[model samples]
Target: MKSLRNLLLGAGILLLGSCNQAPVSAPAEPAPVDKAAIVLENIMTRASVRSFTAEPVSRETLQTIVRAGLQAPSAMNKQDWEVRVVDSQDKINAICDIMKKANPNAQDRFPDKNSFGNAAALIFIANEVSDQPGAFSAVDAALLAENIVLAAHAMDLGACIQAGPLRSMESAEAQAWLKSLGFSENYQPMLVIPIGHPDQEVTAGQRDASKAKFVE
Candidate 1:
């Protein structure tokens, strides 16, 4: 009987030791990121970049920016907008020449005759006149234009919207050039977006909050 009691006590001690052993655990996952906050921060930090490096923007990046522009809201869901992406230096130079010819004094108004920062590409937003009236189409194009710039900024690319190029498209020669760039005669260029890797840093200007009055 003494030997049996000793054996039982030894078994109890081993069981207690096993119970006290540390448990095996699975690896922990990373914390969830706040996507909305990230997007809002991107919007706040966006600035108009007028100067750019010589590095060209890739086709994939340009397509992504265009996708973002198409995601913008349009009037009556008509989506009356067309985009023309011009990346060729020759084509850009031709357009710039037309601009200069259209307005001989454009140089005085703009720092560069191109007014596009000599970006890797130029995105021209035009209205699809058949789908909507000119006034409504213009508003729709403006919304799309903002989306394009914001998308470019989000992707660490610089972009600027200049009226000089679009305004120059009003001339007869400029209109002919537009047709050569694949824009239809019915479509009217509303905005010109120049995109590339930025060469200079830009700071946001101050806004007057008082100018915005809440009716409610």
Candidate 2:
């Protein structure tokens, strides 16, 4: 019995000696990402701004925003979009007048009361209306508009997507205005986006999972 016990203890010691451990692995570090760059997942999380400060947006910055807008995808790669940057105070006031006259009730609905109010610049998206089958140009123009808004927010600028300015003109008036503003007569205004420094901070709306549904 004593010999058997000693043999068992020796076997246990030998088993323990054979069970050696490998080296421990250190955790891998994550790669750094640019904080300012727009990520697709968070793109819709940004806010739309209407109010703006008296501070002006520089021409260089405006160009950057427009360039970003132009990067949006268009059907057939036509990229058939034209942008008009209205920086003149007089033209802005004129646009406001047109809005007021066109929509008499706009004063009550849009009480802030002006196109490009205190806005450093207004971005007008246009496309050749005759070139599309049915409002395709306008649809392309809208895509560009949304891109401009996202780019504006990413660049720390405030932007307001407005429908008032575009609705004020009839076909004739729109064509005339387009021609007068140096755009081809065939091009029609699709969106009027006002860009400037934000006077008040805008908080984005909370994500509503129910608002978006996926289908298999």
Per residue, candidate 2 scores C-alpha lDDT tens digits across 60-119 of: 999998998898888787777899998877777765666556666754323563645568
Off by over 4 Å in 2: 1-31, 34-42, 102-105, 108-113, 131-135, 171-178, 206-208, 211-216
lDDT of each: 0.83, 0.76
Which candidate number would show the highest lDDT if scored against the true structure? 1
Name the candidate that leads on TM-score. Answer: 1
Deviation from native of the Cα of residue 49 in model 2, angstroms:
1.0
Q: Encode model 1's per-residue lDDT on 1-216: one tens digit a residue.
A: 999999999999999999998787887888999999998988888888877777999899999999999998997887879888989978987877877777787663236535577789999899876653344887788889899999999899999877666666788888777887686667877788889998888866678999999898
For candidate 2, the lDDT comes to 0.76
